[model samples]
Target: MAVSLGFASGAIVQEFYVDDDVDRSIRDSVEAETGQALVDVDYGDVVDGAIVWWRAEDAEEEDLADVLVDAMSNLDDGGLIWVLIPKAGRPNSVRVGDVEEAAGIAGLHATTSTALGQNWAGVRLTARPRSRR
Candidate 1:
């Protein structure tokens, strides 16, 4: 998982922002692989990366654009975000199209997506480069 995300150990410690409702196992694995604990969304510190656990109902409850924007705000420059949603056929699963749309609105692009296991789909997000004048 760390390899796929290009995580590397460096002099500065790497930190990840963990959003709400993420699967415990996935979060644990990430923490173990990254060699550090994850900070919750309220951390208010710029992190190297972020993980957003979302559901279909969450989209209805609040704007996905808002959530993505909030997550992005907590990221460092060149940071990344992994938006994990329930896989197709799973309870509370959201459509990939919707996620992509929200990502676009948040000034991000989906770099890739992969199945996290039997139950979850993970999308990697990166910031869009500023447009040249």
Candidate 2:
């Protein structure tokens, strides 16, 4: 199961990785694949390991999950993936709760919290994602 961050209809978000180099690779790959530039990138960490966050365009639910899972699965031991679903409206507050539910659906564990003085929402999801090996 992967932790999910709910969106408010076409809401852009970010993808985080536990490795800097891996982060760069993911950012570059996502931009190249989507032909869209990242909104931003930042340093951070999660239960799995160190991490960096990169802004991403709004994508479909399954497509977004597949993209994130693919990028995160390449790191050492395959680091975890986190998607930041910022608040948009009255329903934006549901992102964290929705992500928790999403993680359960995917058979992954997740934790959610708010930042920026409770102005933004984020979710961290972890799991032993299936490997091609």
Candidate 3:
């Protein structure tokens, strides 16, 4: 079964730093199920109204946190950030605790996590509500 990230049709989604295997699977599933194309973008792309598919294990935790913060500028209000990481016990898998800490630093919270495929896990996140000034 294809996993749902709560995306709607025509929603703009970006794939950032995911490996070839994971990226291909996500692209196929998103296109087939949601009709939303996952745009491949680098760190400097100006993005908005897009679900960001980030591969957390590609970088160190501290670097990933910084990248998340930077990605915030490109995200639209209510946009989802799906962080893809190597499955537990895999060589390059990121620790769950690191993911949580990075989310906190980036002002987002993880809503759910599920297996993306045989080699990857996906963590769905959303921006935290800002306090009224």
Kindly give the number of clashing pairs for every candidate: 0, 5, 0
For candidate 3, which ten residues in a row score worst on lDDT? Answer: 47-56
Model 3 lDDT tens row, 1-133: 4666677777767666655555466667777666756676663554443343444445644476676776676776777787777788876777667777788888888888888777778777788644568
| Local distance difference test, each candidate | 0.72, 0.42, 0.67
- Kindly report the root-mean-square deviation of model 1 from the true structure over all alpha carbons: 3.6
**Is 1 or 3 the stronger prediction by lDDT?**
1
Give residue 57's lDDT in candidate 3 (0 to 100): 44
List the pairs of residues colliding in candidate 3.
none
- Per-residue lDDT of 1-133 in model 1, one digit per residue for the tens? 3224444332112333334545677765676667777676667666777777888877777888788888877666677788888999998898888889999999999989888866788888898644568
Winner by TM-score: 1
Ranking by lDDT: 1, 3, 2
Q: Which ten residues in a row have the lowest lDDT in candidate 2?
A: 43-52
- Check candidate 2 and list the clashing pairs: 1-106, 1-107, 1-108, 4-99, 18-50
Task: After superposing candidate 1 on the true structure, give the runs of residues whose Cα lies further than 4 Å from its correct spot.
Answer: 1-4, 10-21, 129-133
Write candidate 2's Cα lDDT for 72-95 as tens digits.
444334345455454545322344
